[model samples]
Target: MGFPAGLLVLLSVGALPCQPITHGDSAKQDGHCFQVLPAEEGALNIGRHWGAATPAATVHIDMSKVTSTASSFEFRTLDPEGVIFFGDMGDHDWFVLGLRRGKAEMQINNIMTNISVRGGQRLDDGHWHRMLVMNEGDSVRLEVDDEELLALGHVSYPIIERPVPEMRLAMGGLLLPASHLLSPMNTAMDGCLRRWSWLNQTTTWREGAALRAKAKPCFSALRPGSFFPGAGLASFRPADLAGGTAPPNGSWGLEVELGIRAPRQTGLVLAVGVPDGSLALSLVLQPTAMVVRLGNWTKLRLPLPEGPCLDAPLRLRVSPTQLALQLGNHGGTLPNQPPDFQWLQGTWLGQEGRLFIGGLPDGDKTPRPQEWGAFRGCLRGIRVQGHQLDLDSALFRSDTIWAHSCPGAHEGAEAGRRARGHGAD
Candidate 1:
């Protein structure tokens, strides 16, 4: 899931580490050959041995996220300058010094204390070359894939307290000339610097969600029959109220409220219905609104209105056994028989209705006189505080019935009925 940070350079089979550091006679061993330079100029060569290639690609080493300790960073490449070989037996050119710091002036005799080789595996033929740099204590060891190479002592300047955690970590710089042989695609030069750390830490984004900054919520503006200052919220008239005033009578309506996370998936689902009509309260995912079912709770069966009457001023008439629906007269009804344990038996939001009806249908048979202070089944207004519904302002009239005969008592009811009949004709 994660990648290391470094640029990998390409090297051919028999390219030089530093082109200027020429060899006398070249020989091969273990399926690879190396250019041999005499020991006479070995010290001098080591000092002048600047990495040969100025790789075309660059790899970024992100020190902030390192996870590997014994990790090996390899670059298969050849410097345009030349090649320098290194090995233990001195008989085989097992590795190439792809990168190195210039030799320093030492006061001691024949002892190069500050000399360090930071490269790996060499090339024998004009083929793939490998360079490995490994971290060991305060120093890095250079080696070929399988050969034991020399270990150089490290001396850090005051400016560089820790191993320069972030060296340009790049390839194809001005110092090293570009390789000639079919080198790796400049973009493919990749490598990584490893560090020590746990990978499974929660990022800031995930932490915020877990901390309740982004919590789950739900709302039904259309169901409660109301609107914000913007557009018409859930508009409806008295005639659209579901569970008609008369027994076994029903009406339908529609609702268009914003649902943060609609109830299509899980949780307690509730829908608003128009008066006794075919369409009951159903959730319309795309367009923010609810369709209604038109029927009564009869042993788990509720019939639905049909024929796609997606117009204005839909109606609902609810009865004890059946709920009827009249959508502007394009009479379409849906029937769904509620189960014995139906908490949300009927409700609706009026989108496509002649008259919008707003109401509450809680299972309360009778209450004390004082409790009857508010009305139900028709929403006149709702108060919102801090973007949340204020339960205190939710008014409900328990007895102001808006049935077929006395539809004018509620707003939008009479007009909606006329619209429904006209819609059918």
Candidate 2:
């Protein structure tokens, strides 16, 4: 209902004076003693610093109807120790709202018009309030009901940083915490988010996935190859593998070997293609490596070696039975595997009748952290053991038993989806 009983409008130590704008006070005056100020001028307006002592209760000011382009709305209160806070203090937190996308068209934080109102809400308490903020482009007005609370044309917000606005558009809802911005809030609202509506009712899912237990391996992603530019590469042309089909148990193979100056650790991702274009796989890596398989994107975390020695490279040899992972120094052999490591095997990459390697299955590339050490020595070759189930030589050409596909040639072919046991060079 009304602001918690003793919510006082604080003023700076040398500012005008501490004034408590009560709910019953008339709000039609300019600097009226108990009267709240206009939509453009108030003791909390920019250039006027204010502070007050607050009890343990939460405090919130309703400024949902002011449209002022002034700097910022500033207020402060005393800490429990009686220390005076400068502006909007106590365990202060605030969020400002630009006009909604349909209400007013604005993408970034830059003020395009000269006079507009940016809505705002300030809360020192723990409860929620029906806060509103209106920005008229240049002037921003903050109010409660129609009562003009803080008419701020210009308030200094030196610490607030606005991004370049490349993500999905969202109505602004910032929460300023007691000190600086709290980290937990960032964790809660960090990803792409949108308010649900009738038009967007179809979009309910967020991050993460619900995969079946038995999907097959359908795709592979490798860095430092022709498929990927600048130190990394990935490949999944539907027509290039054993099963060139879009979905339904298409057999696919991928191979990656360390070259001269190769990375110490490399990440890998595998997806299978099923009737609905879904696939699955079991992943493995050394102690120095990390992998993330979430939704359609599988991330590989490769930590480069400290200092320098010879080159150490890792290779993945794909076969129907298992994935042969080999790592060695320069031209040497990889270390021993755990006795039961060979049992860590399964069909990789089968989801939604489609497949993804390192990123999203549909190829929506989101940048994740990846690093591979530069190789000092050269890598000789890679060896895979498997027979192509499909006899079509065009899709399964291999000098070695492991047939690989041609670069950029696996876009779409019905035969690749049905074939089996073909490999990568």
Candidate 3:
């Protein structure tokens, strides 16, 4: 019931014996900085080598000022021009951790197989985040802010198969050229890095004065709700509900406020339907639009304007005859198409199925895989059938209620109600 022995020792030992590498005032957050490698040249070499003899390693980085957008590979390491950890082993056989289409990804190539795991949220939101990458035995784990983003097992092949090359740790820029066979490494990161540690060794700006001078102070606060704490948001299926059904009958409306972090990926914000995947109403977020699927065939796609919606509250309304979407003050509506069946009528929510929010339900009424469009943002103030959902209910808490209060909740809710009424027939 007490603290673990290892944890207690770590706490009692205080700081590691590694020399402190400081620049300017270490006490001031903005006073410390490290520049990103230039697009074509430049790198901060750690001047250390890891090989078969040292197959297990851990890296920690404190990053601030990430760009809003990402290149083919968001953050790369191990070479002057951001080649993967071991580019000499062949591009397809190296271990890489970066962003793929805005999502954090950890990829491992073992000559015969390529394995990757993507995080549920985006990591390039101009915030200060702590990243940890660990290679222990046959597995690799990538974590952001202490949350496990991705983990891969049986990845010991590369460390064992490839010859140990003289490789030093580097950040940003790519050593390889862009080609169809290889993923493009367009531009390096535009951010500040602090307190990077590898295998218990820490590096600071003092070690690289030139790079430190080029880095500007970045005091921008990280946007809230970028990463959910605890278990994050809750997801539910019909069976999870008390009655095994919901929204029983009458002219009911569904409303929810979502803080979208990544709009480029497709995700299921909410769904109500049967066990066989037949949905009465399904709301999805696409790269540039909000898609509403009614019944089986009717679909409404509302395109979002070209701009950043990160942390922007999106309100959605699903009524008997129409679907309304509001992002901030911008709103749009599309009438429910014809051939309306019982599923599209008032009592559809009572059907023998489930209600899923922040994700889709699988056959057994559990959260589906991320590839199946799991929502990647914060959800709150869910109202269905005129009843505001008790997000703090025991059932939802067990399912992970990371945080509450969607961005601009009061305004967004008001706008949602107004937009829902204004767009009605």
| Residues 246-301, model 2: lDDT tens digits | 23455444444432232222433323333232233323232254232222333233
**What is the Å distance of residue 351 in model 2 from its true position?**
11
C-alpha lDDT values of all predictions: 0.23, 0.24, 0.39
User: TM-scores across all candidates?
Assistant: 0.21, 0.21, 0.37
Residue-level error in angstroms, candidate 2, position 228: 2.8
Against the true structure, candidate 1 has what lDDT? 0.23
Q: Once superposed on the true structure, which residue ranges of model 3 sit more than 4 Å away at CA?
A: 1-233, 237-249, 337-341, 344-348, 362-371, 385-401, 405-425
Rank list by lDDT: 3, 2, 1
- Report the lDDT tens digits of candidate 1 across residue range 166-273: 222222222222332212112211111111111211122112223222111111001122111111122233233342222343432222222121111111112333
How many clashes in each candidate?
A: 127, 100, 7
> Residue 33 CA error for candidate 2 (Å)?
70
lDDT of 3 by residue, 165-221 (tens): 322232332223334213443222223233343433233422244433432222112
Return the number of clashes found in candidate 1: 127
Report the C-alpha displacement of residue 79, candidate 3, in angstroms: 43
- Which candidate should be chosen as best, given TM-score against the real structure? 3
